[model samples]
Target: MRGGFCSGGLLLLLLIAPAGAAGTERADRLAFEVPPGMAPAAVAGDETFQGGFTCRSDAGENSAGTTACRSWISPVLPLFVFRLAWHVDSVTAERVVTGIWIGRDGASEPLQEMSGLELRMAVPIENAGFELIDMDFDGHLDMRIVAGGTAGPNVLYRNWLWSVDEERFVDSAALDEIVSPEFDPETREIVSRWRSSAAEGGVDVYAWNDGVPVIVHREVDRFDGPARCIRTFYDRIDEELRETGTGSCG
Candidate 1:
Protein backbone atom coordinates (compact mmCIF):
# COMPACT_ATOMS: atom_id res chain seq x y z
CA MET A 1 0.00 0.00 0.00
CA ARG A 2 2.87 2.34 0.67
CA GLY A 3 4.30 2.43 -2.84
CA GLY A 4 1.14 2.53 -4.91
CA PHE A 5 -1.33 5.10 -3.57
CA CYS A 6 0.93 7.08 -1.25
CA SER A 7 3.41 7.91 -4.01
CA GLY A 8 2.28 11.35 -5.14
CA GLY A 9 -1.23 10.55 -6.34
CA LEU A 10 -3.36 13.51 -7.40
CA LEU A 11 -5.89 13.18 -4.60
CA LEU A 12 -8.25 15.89 -3.37
CA LEU A 13 -8.13 17.17 0.18
CA LEU A 14 -11.17 16.39 2.28
CA LEU A 15 -13.24 19.12 3.86
CA ILE A 16 -12.04 18.19 7.36
CA ALA A 17 -8.26 18.14 7.26
CA PRO A 18 -6.52 15.45 9.24
CA ALA A 19 -5.44 16.66 12.66
CA GLY A 20 -1.75 17.13 13.50
CA ALA A 21 -0.99 20.40 11.71
CA ALA A 22 1.28 20.84 8.69
CA GLY A 23 4.61 19.88 10.29
CA THR A 24 5.95 18.13 13.34
CA GLU A 25 4.96 19.95 16.52
CA ARG A 26 8.08 21.30 18.18
CA ALA A 27 6.78 20.70 21.69
CA ASP A 28 6.08 16.99 21.13
CA ARG A 29 9.36 16.19 19.40
CA LEU A 30 10.83 13.03 20.95
CA ALA A 31 14.54 12.67 21.64
CA PHE A 32 16.54 10.06 19.69
CA GLU A 33 19.32 7.88 21.11
CA VAL A 34 22.73 6.86 19.80
CA PRO A 35 23.92 5.17 22.91
CA PRO A 36 27.44 3.84 23.56
CA GLY A 37 26.58 0.56 21.79
CA MET A 38 23.84 1.24 19.25
CA ALA A 39 25.35 3.42 16.56
CA PRO A 40 23.12 4.35 13.63
CA ALA A 41 24.36 2.82 10.40
CA ALA A 42 23.93 5.16 7.47
CA VAL A 43 21.22 3.70 5.27
CA ALA A 44 22.19 3.18 1.61
CA GLY A 45 19.97 4.14 -1.38
CA ASP A 46 17.84 6.36 0.85
CA GLU A 47 19.01 9.79 -0.28
CA THR A 48 17.06 11.35 2.57
CA PHE A 49 19.87 10.24 4.88
CA GLN A 50 22.67 11.28 2.55
CA GLY A 51 23.74 13.99 4.97
CA GLY A 52 22.92 12.01 8.11
CA PHE A 53 19.10 12.47 8.09
CA THR A 54 17.27 14.51 5.48
CA CYS A 55 13.60 15.42 5.03
CA ARG A 56 13.92 15.91 1.31
CA SER A 57 11.50 13.72 -0.66
CA ASP A 58 11.46 13.34 -4.51
CA ALA A 59 12.62 16.23 -6.64
CA GLY A 60 9.26 17.86 -7.53
CA GLU A 61 7.50 17.28 -4.18
CA ASN A 62 5.67 20.15 -2.50
CA SER A 63 7.78 21.83 0.15
CA ALA A 64 4.82 23.54 1.85
CA GLY A 65 3.41 20.51 3.70
CA THR A 66 3.29 20.04 7.49
CA THR A 67 4.31 17.01 9.64
CA ALA A 68 2.08 17.57 12.71
CA CYS A 69 1.36 15.35 15.80
CA ARG A 70 1.92 11.64 15.01
CA SER A 71 4.83 10.36 17.10
CA TRP A 72 3.91 7.31 19.11
CA ILE A 73 4.99 3.82 20.22
CA SER A 74 4.93 1.02 17.67
CA PRO A 75 1.78 -1.02 18.15
CA VAL A 76 3.75 -4.26 17.88
CA LEU A 77 7.37 -3.15 18.40
CA PRO A 78 6.70 -1.64 21.80
CA LEU A 79 10.39 -0.83 22.15
CA PHE A 80 10.30 1.80 19.38
CA VAL A 81 8.32 4.97 18.65
CA PHE A 82 7.75 7.25 15.63
CA ARG A 83 6.24 10.59 14.61
CA LEU A 84 5.63 12.63 11.43
CA ALA A 85 6.94 16.04 10.40
CA TRP A 86 5.38 17.88 7.43
CA HIS A 87 8.65 19.62 6.91
CA VAL A 88 11.89 18.30 8.42
CA ASP A 89 12.97 21.93 8.69
CA SER A 90 10.00 22.65 10.97
CA VAL A 91 11.93 21.51 14.03
CA THR A 92 15.28 22.21 15.62
CA ALA A 93 18.17 20.03 14.49
CA GLU A 94 18.13 18.00 17.71
CA ARG A 95 14.36 17.34 17.67
CA VAL A 96 13.94 16.45 13.99
CA VAL A 97 12.79 12.81 13.69
CA THR A 98 14.40 11.97 10.34
CA GLY A 99 14.11 8.20 10.75
CA ILE A 100 13.05 5.47 13.13
CA TRP A 101 15.08 5.36 16.32
CA ILE A 102 15.73 3.29 19.42
CA GLY A 103 13.17 4.87 21.73
CA ARG A 104 12.73 5.76 25.42
CA ASP A 105 14.12 2.54 26.88
CA GLY A 106 16.81 3.00 29.46
CA ALA A 107 19.06 0.64 27.50
CA SER A 108 22.56 2.04 27.99
CA GLU A 109 23.25 1.33 24.31
CA PRO A 110 21.41 1.31 20.96
CA LEU A 111 19.35 -1.73 20.07
CA GLN A 112 18.95 -1.83 16.26
CA GLU A 113 18.50 0.49 13.32
CA MET A 114 18.09 0.13 9.54
CA SER A 115 21.36 0.18 7.62
CA GLY A 116 20.02 2.33 4.77
CA LEU A 117 17.00 4.29 3.56
CA GLU A 118 15.72 5.04 0.03
CA LEU A 119 13.10 7.80 0.17
CA ARG A 120 10.85 8.17 -2.92
CA MET A 121 9.09 11.46 -2.21
CA ALA A 122 10.43 14.91 -3.03
CA VAL A 123 11.58 15.32 0.56
CA PRO A 124 10.79 13.79 3.90
CA ILE A 125 10.02 17.35 5.00
CA GLU A 126 6.86 17.48 2.92
CA ASN A 127 4.38 15.49 5.07
CA ALA A 128 4.73 12.03 6.49
CA GLY A 129 4.35 9.62 9.45
CA PHE A 130 4.72 5.95 10.43
CA GLU A 131 2.32 3.14 11.34
CA LEU A 132 3.57 -0.10 12.91
CA ILE A 133 1.28 -3.09 12.70
CA ASP A 134 1.17 -6.73 11.53
CA MET A 135 0.18 -6.38 7.91
CA ASP A 136 1.34 -9.94 7.25
CA PHE A 137 -0.11 -11.54 10.43
CA ASP A 138 3.25 -13.01 11.40
CA GLY A 139 2.81 -12.15 15.10
CA HIS A 140 5.93 -10.03 14.77
CA LEU A 141 5.30 -6.52 13.35
CA ASP A 142 5.16 -4.58 10.07
CA MET A 143 5.83 -0.90 9.38
CA ARG A 144 4.31 1.62 6.97
CA ILE A 145 6.26 4.85 6.51
CA VAL A 146 4.52 7.72 4.77
CA ALA A 147 6.15 10.92 3.53
CA GLY A 148 4.52 14.00 2.10
CA GLY A 149 1.07 15.31 3.02
CA THR A 150 -2.11 13.20 3.33
CA ALA A 151 -3.04 13.85 -0.30
CA GLY A 152 -2.15 15.55 -3.56
CA PRO A 153 0.98 14.83 -5.63
CA ASN A 154 3.42 15.27 -2.72
CA VAL A 155 2.58 12.23 -0.58
CA LEU A 156 5.08 9.40 -0.07
CA TYR A 157 4.59 5.81 1.10
CA ARG A 158 6.88 2.98 2.18
CA ASN A 159 6.30 -0.36 3.95
CA TRP A 160 8.59 -2.78 5.75
CA LEU A 161 7.09 -6.22 6.23
CA TRP A 162 8.69 -8.42 8.86
CA SER A 163 10.20 -11.56 7.40
CA VAL A 164 10.21 -14.29 9.99
CA ASP A 165 12.16 -16.67 7.78
CA GLU A 166 14.97 -14.18 7.20
CA GLU A 167 14.49 -12.43 10.54
CA ARG A 168 14.75 -9.02 8.95
CA PHE A 169 12.73 -6.17 7.50
CA VAL A 170 12.26 -6.24 3.74
CA ASP A 171 10.59 -3.90 1.28
CA SER A 172 6.92 -4.71 0.68
CA ALA A 173 5.47 -4.36 -2.82
CA ALA A 174 1.97 -5.70 -2.09
CA LEU A 175 0.49 -2.64 -0.42
CA ASP A 176 -1.80 0.15 -1.61
CA GLU A 177 -0.83 3.22 0.37
CA ILE A 178 -0.08 2.89 4.03
CA VAL A 179 -1.70 6.20 4.84
CA SER A 180 -2.97 4.67 8.04
CA PRO A 181 -4.37 1.59 6.28
CA GLU A 182 -6.94 -0.58 8.04
CA PHE A 183 -6.97 -4.36 8.15
CA ASP A 184 -9.67 -6.96 8.83
CA PRO A 185 -8.59 -10.43 9.90
CA GLU A 186 -11.96 -12.08 9.39
CA THR A 187 -11.94 -11.23 5.69
CA ARG A 188 -8.19 -11.24 5.40
CA GLU A 189 -8.27 -7.91 3.64
CA ILE A 190 -6.89 -4.37 3.91
CA VAL A 191 -9.19 -1.39 3.71
CA SER A 192 -8.56 2.30 3.04
CA ARG A 193 -10.73 5.42 3.06
CA TRP A 194 -9.53 8.67 1.56
CA ARG A 195 -10.65 11.91 -0.04
CA SER A 196 -10.45 11.50 -3.81
CA SER A 197 -11.80 14.93 -4.69
CA ALA A 198 -13.52 18.03 -3.38
CA ALA A 199 -16.92 16.28 -3.54
CA GLU A 200 -16.01 12.64 -4.19
CA GLY A 201 -14.09 9.76 -2.68
CA GLY A 202 -14.65 6.19 -1.52
CA VAL A 203 -13.68 3.11 0.46
CA ASP A 204 -11.57 0.25 -0.90
CA VAL A 205 -10.98 -3.26 0.46
CA TYR A 206 -8.05 -5.26 -0.86
CA ALA A 207 -7.07 -8.88 -0.41
CA TRP A 208 -3.68 -10.49 -0.91
CA ASN A 209 -3.53 -12.01 -4.39
CA ASP A 210 -0.19 -13.50 -5.39
CA GLY A 211 1.39 -11.55 -2.52
CA VAL A 212 0.04 -8.17 -3.63
CA PRO A 213 -3.05 -6.36 -2.43
CA VAL A 214 -5.99 -6.57 -4.84
CA ILE A 215 -9.05 -4.38 -4.48
CA VAL A 216 -11.88 -6.74 -3.64
CA HIS A 217 -14.58 -4.22 -2.95
CA ARG A 218 -15.20 -0.50 -3.33
CA GLU A 219 -17.85 1.99 -2.15
CA VAL A 220 -17.66 5.41 -3.68
CA ASP A 221 -19.63 8.56 -2.79
CA ARG A 222 -20.02 11.60 -5.00
CA PHE A 223 -21.63 15.01 -4.56
CA ASP A 224 -22.71 16.89 -7.64
CA GLY A 225 -24.78 20.06 -7.77
CA PRO A 226 -27.46 19.68 -5.07
CA ALA A 227 -27.19 15.91 -4.94
CA ARG A 228 -25.17 13.23 -3.20
CA CYS A 229 -24.74 9.71 -4.55
CA ILE A 230 -22.99 6.45 -3.70
CA ARG A 231 -21.83 3.43 -5.70
CA THR A 232 -20.47 0.03 -4.70
CA PHE A 233 -18.37 -2.59 -6.48
CA TYR A 234 -17.33 -6.11 -5.58
CA ASP A 235 -14.33 -7.97 -6.86
CA ARG A 236 -13.48 -11.70 -7.02
CA ILE A 237 -15.27 -12.51 -3.78
CA ASP A 238 -18.37 -14.54 -3.10
CA GLU A 239 -20.13 -12.92 -0.17
CA GLU A 240 -23.14 -10.73 0.34
CA LEU A 241 -22.08 -7.16 1.09
CA ARG A 242 -24.26 -5.16 3.44
CA GLU A 243 -23.31 -1.52 3.83
CA THR A 244 -24.68 0.95 6.35
CA GLY A 245 -23.77 4.64 6.60
CA THR A 246 -24.60 7.33 9.13
CA GLY A 247 -24.78 11.11 9.59
CA SER A 248 -23.96 13.98 7.24
CA CYS A 249 -22.20 17.32 7.31
CA GLY A 250 -24.38 20.36 8.06
Candidate 2:
Protein backbone atom coordinates (compact mmCIF):
# COMPACT_ATOMS: atom_id res chain seq x y z
CA MET A 1 0.00 0.00 0.00
CA ARG A 2 1.07 3.57 -0.64
CA GLY A 3 1.68 6.09 2.13
CA GLY A 4 -1.30 7.72 3.81
CA PHE A 5 -1.84 11.26 5.08
CA CYS A 6 -0.40 12.43 8.37
CA SER A 7 -2.96 13.27 11.08
CA GLY A 8 -2.49 16.98 10.22
CA GLY A 9 0.52 18.35 8.40
CA LEU A 10 0.21 21.97 9.53
CA LEU A 11 -0.66 20.88 13.07
CA LEU A 12 2.87 19.76 13.63
CA LEU A 13 4.16 23.28 13.10
CA LEU A 14 1.67 24.88 15.47
CA LEU A 15 2.51 22.37 18.19
CA ILE A 16 6.26 22.29 17.77
CA ALA A 17 6.96 26.03 17.43
CA PRO A 18 5.72 27.06 20.86
CA ALA A 19 7.17 23.99 22.55
CA GLY A 20 10.63 24.67 21.17
CA ALA A 21 10.52 28.34 22.10
CA ALA A 22 9.39 27.52 25.61
CA GLY A 23 11.98 24.80 26.03
CA THR A 24 14.72 27.24 25.05
CA GLU A 25 13.46 29.80 27.52
CA ARG A 26 13.42 27.23 30.31
CA ALA A 27 16.85 25.91 29.44
CA ASP A 28 18.20 29.45 29.40
CA ARG A 29 17.09 30.00 32.98
CA LEU A 30 17.96 26.71 34.64
CA ALA A 31 21.49 25.64 35.50
CA PHE A 32 22.09 21.93 34.96
CA GLU A 33 24.87 19.72 33.61
CA VAL A 34 24.15 18.34 30.17
CA PRO A 35 25.79 15.07 28.99
CA PRO A 36 27.03 14.53 32.61
CA GLY A 37 30.68 15.66 32.70
CA MET A 38 30.63 18.89 30.67
CA ALA A 39 31.57 21.77 32.93
CA PRO A 40 29.16 24.71 32.70
CA ALA A 41 30.66 27.63 30.81
CA ALA A 42 29.61 30.49 28.60
CA VAL A 43 28.88 29.43 25.04
CA ALA A 44 29.32 31.64 21.98
CA GLY A 45 30.99 34.24 24.24
CA ASP A 46 27.92 34.82 26.39
CA GLU A 47 29.15 35.35 29.93
CA THR A 48 26.22 33.85 31.85
CA PHE A 49 26.35 30.28 30.54
CA GLN A 50 25.49 28.11 33.55
CA GLY A 51 24.12 25.06 31.76
CA GLY A 52 21.86 26.02 28.84
CA PHE A 53 21.95 29.57 27.45
CA THR A 54 20.17 31.94 25.11
CA CYS A 55 21.75 35.07 23.62
CA ARG A 56 19.68 37.65 21.82
CA SER A 57 20.41 40.61 19.57
CA ASP A 58 19.75 43.88 21.30
CA ALA A 59 16.32 45.09 20.25
CA GLY A 60 17.06 48.75 20.91
CA GLU A 61 20.33 48.80 19.01
CA ASN A 62 20.67 48.74 15.23
CA SER A 63 23.74 46.55 15.18
CA ALA A 64 23.98 43.51 12.91
CA GLY A 65 22.08 40.37 13.92
CA THR A 66 24.56 39.05 16.47
CA THR A 67 22.38 37.12 18.86
CA ALA A 68 23.22 33.45 19.53
CA CYS A 69 21.04 30.87 21.22
CA ARG A 70 22.25 27.53 22.59
CA SER A 71 20.17 24.37 22.95
CA TRP A 72 21.09 20.74 23.63
CA ILE A 73 19.88 18.28 21.04
CA SER A 74 18.21 15.18 22.46
CA PRO A 75 19.07 11.54 21.65
CA VAL A 76 22.21 12.17 19.61
CA LEU A 77 25.28 9.98 19.64
CA PRO A 78 28.49 11.49 21.02
CA LEU A 79 26.16 14.09 22.54
CA PHE A 80 26.72 17.71 21.57
CA VAL A 81 25.00 21.12 21.52
CA PHE A 82 24.44 23.52 18.65
CA ARG A 83 24.42 27.31 18.72
CA LEU A 84 22.34 29.27 16.22
CA ALA A 85 23.46 32.87 15.67
CA TRP A 86 21.22 35.57 14.26
CA HIS A 87 22.41 38.63 12.37
CA VAL A 88 20.28 41.54 11.25
CA ASP A 89 20.58 42.57 7.64
CA SER A 90 21.72 46.17 7.36
CA VAL A 91 19.37 47.17 4.59
CA THR A 92 16.40 44.82 5.03
CA ALA A 93 16.55 44.88 8.83
CA GLU A 94 15.52 41.23 8.89
CA ARG A 95 16.93 38.86 11.46
CA VAL A 96 18.76 35.99 9.79
CA VAL A 97 19.91 32.81 11.51
CA THR A 98 22.72 30.42 10.69
CA GLY A 99 24.39 27.49 12.41
CA ILE A 100 27.59 28.72 14.00
CA TRP A 101 29.03 26.07 16.29
CA ILE A 102 28.70 22.39 17.26
CA GLY A 103 30.52 21.27 20.39
CA ARG A 104 30.64 18.06 22.37
CA ASP A 105 30.99 17.65 26.10
CA GLY A 106 34.49 18.23 27.51
CA ALA A 107 35.76 19.79 24.29
CA SER A 108 37.75 23.02 24.66
CA GLU A 109 36.75 24.11 21.18
CA PRO A 110 33.84 23.30 18.91
CA LEU A 111 33.89 20.05 16.96
CA GLN A 112 32.93 21.93 13.84
CA GLU A 113 32.55 25.54 12.75
CA MET A 114 29.47 25.18 10.51
CA SER A 115 29.81 26.67 7.03
CA GLY A 116 27.78 27.15 3.86
CA LEU A 117 24.88 28.28 5.99
CA GLU A 118 21.76 29.26 4.08
CA LEU A 119 20.65 32.47 5.74
CA ARG A 120 16.93 32.40 6.66
CA MET A 121 14.93 35.19 8.24
CA ALA A 122 13.06 34.46 11.43
CA VAL A 123 10.60 37.37 12.00
CA PRO A 124 9.55 36.76 15.57
CA ILE A 125 13.04 35.55 16.49
CA GLU A 126 11.56 33.83 19.55
CA ASN A 127 10.15 31.13 17.27
CA ALA A 128 13.56 30.83 15.61
CA GLY A 129 15.25 27.58 16.71
CA PHE A 130 16.74 24.29 15.53
CA GLU A 131 15.65 20.65 15.58
CA LEU A 132 17.79 17.52 15.12
CA ILE A 133 16.10 14.68 13.22
CA ASP A 134 17.14 12.00 10.77
CA MET A 135 15.89 13.36 7.45
CA ASP A 136 16.76 10.34 5.26
CA PHE A 137 16.24 7.75 7.99
CA ASP A 138 19.95 7.02 7.85
CA GLY A 139 20.12 6.66 11.68
CA HIS A 140 21.95 9.98 11.89
CA LEU A 141 20.45 13.22 13.10
CA ASP A 142 20.24 16.16 10.68
CA MET A 143 19.55 19.80 11.46
CA ARG A 144 16.39 21.69 10.48
CA ILE A 145 15.75 25.31 11.44
CA VAL A 146 12.69 27.52 11.21
CA ALA A 147 13.52 29.13 7.90
CA GLY A 148 11.16 32.08 7.74
CA GLY A 149 8.38 34.03 9.36
CA THR A 150 5.39 31.93 10.51
CA ALA A 151 2.59 34.40 9.85
CA GLY A 152 0.96 31.75 7.70
CA PRO A 153 -0.01 28.32 8.91
CA ASN A 154 2.32 26.72 6.40
CA VAL A 155 5.76 26.85 7.99
CA LEU A 156 8.95 26.27 6.00
CA TYR A 157 12.28 24.83 7.20
CA ARG A 158 15.90 25.05 6.05
CA ASN A 159 17.35 21.54 6.12
CA TRP A 160 20.90 20.22 6.59
CA LEU A 161 21.39 16.46 6.26
CA TRP A 162 24.19 14.91 8.29
CA SER A 163 26.92 13.17 6.34
CA VAL A 164 28.42 10.40 8.46
CA ASP A 165 31.43 9.64 6.29
CA GLU A 166 32.29 13.30 5.84
CA GLU A 167 31.58 14.08 9.48
CA ARG A 168 29.63 17.24 8.62
CA PHE A 169 26.21 18.57 7.70
CA VAL A 170 25.24 18.99 4.07
CA ASP A 171 22.44 21.33 3.08
CA SER A 172 19.61 19.83 0.98
CA ALA A 173 17.65 22.37 -1.05
CA ALA A 174 15.20 19.70 -2.24
CA LEU A 175 14.34 18.68 1.29
CA ASP A 176 14.04 22.32 2.37
CA GLU A 177 11.41 22.95 -0.29
CA ILE A 178 9.12 20.20 0.98
CA VAL A 179 6.47 21.82 3.17
CA SER A 180 5.17 20.07 6.24
CA PRO A 181 7.34 17.05 5.46
CA GLU A 182 6.95 13.69 7.18
CA PHE A 183 9.21 10.67 6.83
CA ASP A 184 7.95 7.09 6.58
CA PRO A 185 10.71 4.72 7.61
CA GLU A 186 8.71 1.65 6.68
CA THR A 187 8.24 2.72 3.06
CA ARG A 188 11.35 4.89 2.93
CA GLU A 189 9.37 7.80 1.53
CA ILE A 190 8.90 11.50 2.30
CA VAL A 191 5.43 13.07 2.34
CA SER A 192 4.59 16.74 2.02
CA ARG A 193 1.26 18.57 2.14
CA TRP A 194 0.51 22.05 0.84
CA ARG A 195 -2.48 24.36 1.07
CA SER A 196 -3.03 26.95 -1.62
CA SER A 197 -6.30 28.25 -0.27
CA ALA A 198 -9.22 27.22 1.89
CA ALA A 199 -10.63 25.25 -1.04
CA GLU A 200 -7.42 24.19 -2.74
CA GLY A 201 -4.61 22.00 -1.41
CA GLY A 202 -2.55 18.94 -2.38
CA VAL A 203 -0.31 16.18 -1.15
CA ASP A 204 3.02 15.20 -2.66
CA VAL A 205 4.93 11.94 -2.13
CA TYR A 206 8.67 11.97 -2.76
CA ALA A 207 11.33 9.31 -3.15
CA TRP A 208 15.03 9.86 -2.52
CA ASN A 209 17.25 9.39 -5.54
CA ASP A 210 21.01 9.90 -5.27
CA GLY A 211 20.58 11.92 -2.03
CA VAL A 212 17.88 14.16 -3.52
CA PRO A 213 14.11 14.14 -3.18
CA VAL A 214 12.11 13.50 -6.34
CA ILE A 215 8.35 13.63 -6.58
CA VAL A 216 6.80 10.27 -7.33
CA HIS A 217 3.09 10.96 -6.83
CA ARG A 218 0.73 13.86 -6.23
CA GLU A 219 -2.89 14.30 -5.09
CA VAL A 220 -4.78 17.55 -5.49
CA ASP A 221 -8.15 18.48 -4.05
CA ARG A 222 -10.25 21.56 -4.75
CA PHE A 223 -13.87 22.64 -4.54
CA ASP A 224 -15.56 22.63 -7.93
CA GLY A 225 -18.85 24.32 -7.00
CA PRO A 226 -20.96 25.39 -4.07
CA ALA A 227 -20.87 21.94 -2.54
CA ARG A 228 -18.85 19.87 -4.96
CA CYS A 229 -15.20 18.88 -4.51
CA ILE A 230 -12.90 17.03 -6.89
CA ARG A 231 -9.78 14.98 -6.33
CA THR A 232 -7.12 14.50 -8.97
CA PHE A 233 -4.23 12.05 -8.91
CA TYR A 234 -0.94 12.35 -10.72
CA ASP A 235 1.98 10.01 -11.09
CA ARG A 236 5.54 10.97 -11.88
CA ILE A 237 6.61 9.44 -15.17
CA ASP A 238 9.89 10.24 -16.93
CA GLU A 239 10.53 12.96 -14.34
CA GLU A 240 7.18 14.66 -14.82
CA LEU A 241 3.97 14.68 -12.82
CA ARG A 242 1.24 13.53 -15.19
CA GLU A 243 -2.43 13.46 -14.27
CA THR A 244 -3.66 9.89 -14.28
CA GLY A 245 -7.15 9.81 -12.76
CA THR A 246 -9.89 11.64 -10.92
CA GLY A 247 -12.31 10.78 -8.16
CA SER A 248 -14.53 12.20 -5.45
CA CYS A 249 -12.75 14.19 -2.83
CA GLY A 250 -11.73 11.98 0.06
lDDT of all predictions = 0.42, 0.59
TM values, all candidates: 0.48, 0.66
Predict model 1's lDDT versus the native: 0.42
Candidate 2 per-residue lDDT over residues 1-250, each given as its tens digit:
2323422301111111245676456334422344444433333432222233333432323443333334433234455645555556777766666445666644536666654455565456463456655577665557777776333456678888878777777778888788878777567788888887777777889988888899998888888776897878888888798988877675
Off by over 4 Å in 2: 1-32, 35-76, 87-95, 115-127, 149-152
Backbone clashes (count) for model 2: 3
- Model 2 clash pairs are 65-86, 65-87, 65-88
Q: For all candidates, what are the clash counts? A: 31, 3
After superposition on all C-alphas, the RMSD of every candidate to the true structure, in Å, is 14.5, 11.0
For model 1 the local lDDT of residue 121 reads 43
- lDDT score for candidate 2 against the true structure: 0.59
- Candidate with top TM-score is 2
